[model samples]
Target: MTIYILLLLIAMQLIGVYFFQNLEDRFYENFRDNLEKQAGILQEVIKDKMTPGTESEKQRKAIDDILNKLPLDKKNTIQIVDQESVVIATTSGENSRIGQKNKSPRVSRVLQGIESPSVEVSHKAGNRYMVYSYPIKNDGDIIGAVYIEAPMQEMYDTIRTVSKILIKITAAAMVGTSLLGIILARTITNPVKEITEQATVMAEGDFNRKVTVKSDDEIGKLASAFNHLAQHLRDALSQNEEEKGRLQSVLANMSDGVIATDRKGKVIVSNRRARKMLGKDIELNEDINQVLPLANPISFPLTEERESFLELNRDEDETLILKLTFTPVLRASREAVGLILVLQDVTEEEKLDRQRKEFVANVSHELRTPLTTIKSYLEALDEGGAMEEPELASRFLRVTRQEAERMTRLIHDLLQLSKLDSEKVRFHKQPLRLEELLEDAADRFSFQCRQKDIAFSLSIRKPLPRVYADRDQIDRVLDNLLSNAVKYTPEGQSVSLSAHRRSDGYVEVVVSDKGIGIPKKDLDRIFERFYRVDKARSRSMGGTGLGLAIAREIVQAHGGTIRMDSRYGEGTTVRFTLPPCEPEVNPA
Candidate 1:
């Protein structure tokens, strides 16, 4: 607006200056021409009244009368000169023209008839004047010259008045033009300002702001387009937020651990499972190196044609395994921005898969041995004409029966393990005295202990707390622990069972053995199905490797915990805790 106003002001000033100069020039030209004409008429009258060659009183009166009739005032002076350049008469309140020569060279030249009648400058009475010279001729002979002087003050005064009017008009016109320019500019710029503010809001991520379009001009069209764009942006941003929320929900509830990192390998986000795996002390924005230093060297392929996995050991004690996979997240430009690290805890899955394979192989081996023995015995009986030797037949039959019993035992253990794996076993819960249960389990294992020549003892603290458990499951649990102790202990070694009250109001039953103890490294995983510290010795003793596993499950179902403390070449203690049952109250 200011620029437009400035341009209008400049243009008006230029036009005003041009008009005032032209007006001044025309005023001066017309004023000078009229003055010269009046002076010429006065000169003709004086020449007509004059007698030839002599000055007469009549001519003098005629000159004075002509001068009086002339429009000469104090601002104008008139003088008459002869052909000799001598002053003949004057209108400056003087009669000294009889001998005075015309000092103006222009007037002298005119009297000599060598110059045209013209206007020139004359100096008189201490003022400058415009003088017009004319010749009075008789019969084409130059007789006298007329000179008129008009002061330039009136022209100067007229020009000054016109100049003042022009200045005032120029200023008024400039002000009016500036105001009009500001109004017009505002009409355009005000809407643009509003659009600019709305654009700023949009840049700051507030897509809901819209610009108002009030006209069909270019600026209005721009505003309309901007509003439409903002609406679309708002919808897209809302959808993006909802998608992000769904992604977060999936990550939160996923069983597998997930960690996401930027291109710089800095941690960007982590799910609950990932945080737990990395330890709760870590937080977002922490370096991945700090959380998984060992796994940092394991890289995953994220390209379209590449897929790689890193097998990570999460627990050294239990051989817990995680499969880490990486996938790339790309922008619309197909630039890789970051990576997604997916951690699948495959410990249980992998263990179960290995167990299935081992079970098939072990079942084949166990059945093969028994079937081979029975087949050999039956073949011997069939080939030897054994009806002539009844004693040999009976022995062969007894051996066949023993082989069949072995097969039955192997099948039973396999079925029990299968039932446990499928969670098909149901337990009946009841309160049982811990000491009595321990005693019964020990008595069932006395025969094995006697064969091994291992002494067994039981220590029951007085007033031992009764435990809430499934009676049959507790019996199996106690039998498993006692039989394991007796089998592992050397001959003449003592295996002891103790029951006592724990500080946390639970009952603790500890079965300790003087045996070739387990190594510290294998203690934590002793309860895993089919895990054996000494595979050869355990199998030689008819161990199915599922006893401790079943015991663990039963204890957990009864709201109890089992743990082992062992030292190599020293001794081992297996302690289990069961919550005490509240005493039944009589009717009060």
Candidate 2:
């Protein structure tokens, strides 16, 4: 900007100097031309009197008269010369070079008619002069020459003064131009500087600053665009951050584990669940193939698709059944940018489904057996077996009734279990003395215990906690437990039912027996419907296999827990708790 200003100032000064110089030169030229015209008028006045027959006095008188009458100023020294090249008259008065021979070469040329009257500057008497000579003619014949000398010192002095004024103006103009140019340059440079700083800040990832718009010009528009661009970048960054947060939130909260990888199969994103479900050592920004043991997980999909499930045995106790869904996240150009792997844990669902299938088969088998038995007996009765042996026929009829009863009990228990599973069983909850309930349940099962030669006993601790529960449901739970104890116990073995106050605000009922103890491995599944340690013995003893299952559901519905503890070759204990009713507060 400074350079441009300076150049502009110099050019303006140069033009001023050139124009003023021409004006000065032209002024001097007009001054010389005026002098030549005055010289020609003086020669014309005397040329007619200077005929070859005329005397010098007559021609000189005419020249003096004409010079006096004409407007030729005294700045020029006018003199008249004859063809003899001698001065005849002068404007300098009589004492000024009268009857003197002219010594100028240009005056001699005009006398010889070798040149026209012309003007030239000469320095004489310490002053510069414009000397002009013209030929005096009469009747188309040259007679004498007239000479004029104009002093140019004063004109040059005036011209120098004018040039000085012009120079001053030009200098002022140049200085003004420089100052104005600097201001204009700042208009461009200052905004540019600001924009540069702002751009630098933007490079550092800050788009919050804006350039100051000081004008409505192109530069101002540029600043506006820059600010807009900065805002756009900020919005884009914010949007990206929001999207990243949303993606991470979704990944974290997803029930299924998720892993995303780059085009190179490098794990770019993973969640805690993914790490836990895949393996504890799974790390991000590592090769997916290396981090997780996969057979061919890196076979990236050419398009959006789903693959088969991949099952991983995470540990001895848990198997992670993951349905690995492979999908390609493509760009607008239809190029696969990366791969997404969805890991859905199906361990529990699969286990329940498998259990359901087993339960169906077990129920079918249980139902088929009794039906088969009844069918065989009825067929026998219809085949005239009653006529062959009355005792045998009576026995067959008893067997049929027993099988039918078993079938009815199985069906009833199955219906009860279905209601329990669906949570459709309504309860009539009320406070009841748990010890009294225990005594009643024990008495009901006492006869059966005696028939099996199993000793039945009840242990009730003092101040036994009263439980809030459905009476009918609880009585059934007690019946099932006592029946199992009596049927499974060896002959003369003791089965005890105990009620006590547990510290956790509940009444605990423990039905324990020195019976055929369950295997240790089967304890985990003891409450599952239709699961029995010894199925043959259980069926023979009229065990429907849904007793413990029903007991668990009823106890749990009352906000309690039922647990079974058993050891192979040792006694088994099935204990359950019922929440006690809240104590009533008397009004103060």
Candidate 3:
């Protein structure tokens, strides 16, 4: 707008100067032309009158009469001068310049028969004049000259008035142009400025501000389009954020660790589980091969390949077996652009599978030994001589009965273990006095201790806490512990059962025996099914090797914990704790 106003101002100024200058030039040219024509007409009419015979006063009078008849204004002056450059007649202000020698160069030249007109300033009248001289000739002989003077004050006054009007017009034009410039600026510049500001804000990720549209012009339409584009951009950004949030949620809650990499094999996305499984040092843009535990290195142009199980040994106590599944992320063109690697920790599953195999093998081995013995004895009795001797046959049948009983015990233990594993066994729980249960178990194991010639004792702390447990299961647990203690104790060794209330609100029952204790290495596996430190001695003594495992399961089902503390060649102490009964439950 300002530029427009400045351009208009300059144009107006140039045009105004040109028009005024031309008008002044034309005005002066027409004034001079009219003055010269009038002077010529006066010279022609008075030329015969100003010839040699006429008196100077009559000639002047004749010129005045002619000028009066020619409609000349009072501001004009005409003079007739003779051959001597002397003024004869004057019409300026009634004989003001009469009988005066006109010494002007123009008049002298006309008297010499050369006519010329020139401009000069009159010192007497203090005015500028356009002087014209004309030679009065009679029959080609110069007789007198005519001198004319026209004052230019009126043209000067008219030029001054026109100049003032032109200045006023130019000023008025400039003022109006400035006002229009301001209006145009408001109409156009303001909206463009608002749109630019909104665009800047949108660049900085804020799309909530809108431009105000005041008109339905081009600028307003542009602003509307900008607003629409901003809305679409804002929606697109919102959807991207929501998708990112859902992806993060899925990755965080997934059981398997997930890691996503770009085509360059740099990690792009990793979740909490992935970081935990890998390590805290795992970071975005890190090389996937460096952090991931894979049996083989990852390659570009990844394929849908499952790597072999990789072992991650954190410590001696904890080892992890992870299965890595690599899946290539493909675009719609079926081009592999990245990779998604999933890590599944299958350590516990692998351990369970191995245990299942071992359990099956052990069950078969346990059943086969007895079945083989019974088969061998039956075959011998089937021979003719063996069946004919009654004593020998009775001996063989007794051995066969013992072997069958061992098989039955093995099968029963295996079934119980299976029930525990599947959580199919339900406990019928009730409140019971810990001291009475200890005494009952000690009495049941008394005969076994006597047969081994080992002394058994029971110690009960007074006011022992009662426990809530299934009576039959608790009895079996007690029987397993006592039988083991009696069977392992040497003759003349001592075994003790004690019950007490512990500080952590549990009833602690301990069975300690001065027997050949377990080795430190075998202590950890003592509670495992079919695991025996002395396998040969245990099998010979009619042990199924599942007693301790069953005991642990029953104790855990009652919400208790069991542990063993044994020193090689010293003694063994097995202790278990059960939660005390609530105050509301009456003791059984």
Highest lDDT against the true fold, candidate: 3
The clash count for each model shown is 1, 0, 0
User: What's the CA error at residue 587 for candidate 3, in Å?
Assistant: 9.6
- Sorted on lDDT, best first, the list reads 3, 2, 1
Best by TM-score: 2
**CA shift of 474, model 2, Å:** 2.3
Q: Model 2 compared with the native: what TM-score? A: 0.74
Model 1, 202: alpha-carbon shift in Å? 14
> How much is the lDDT of residue 151 in candidate 3?
81
Position 575, candidate 2: lDDT: 91
- Model 3 CA RMSD to the hidden true structure, in angstroms: 6.9
| RMSD list, candidates in order | 7.2, 5.6, 6.9
Q: Where does candidate 1 have its weakest 10-residue lDDT segment?
A: 300-309
> What are the runs in model 3 whose C-alpha is more than 4 Å off?
1-172, 207-256, 303-308, 377-398, 421-437, 463-472, 503-506, 578-588
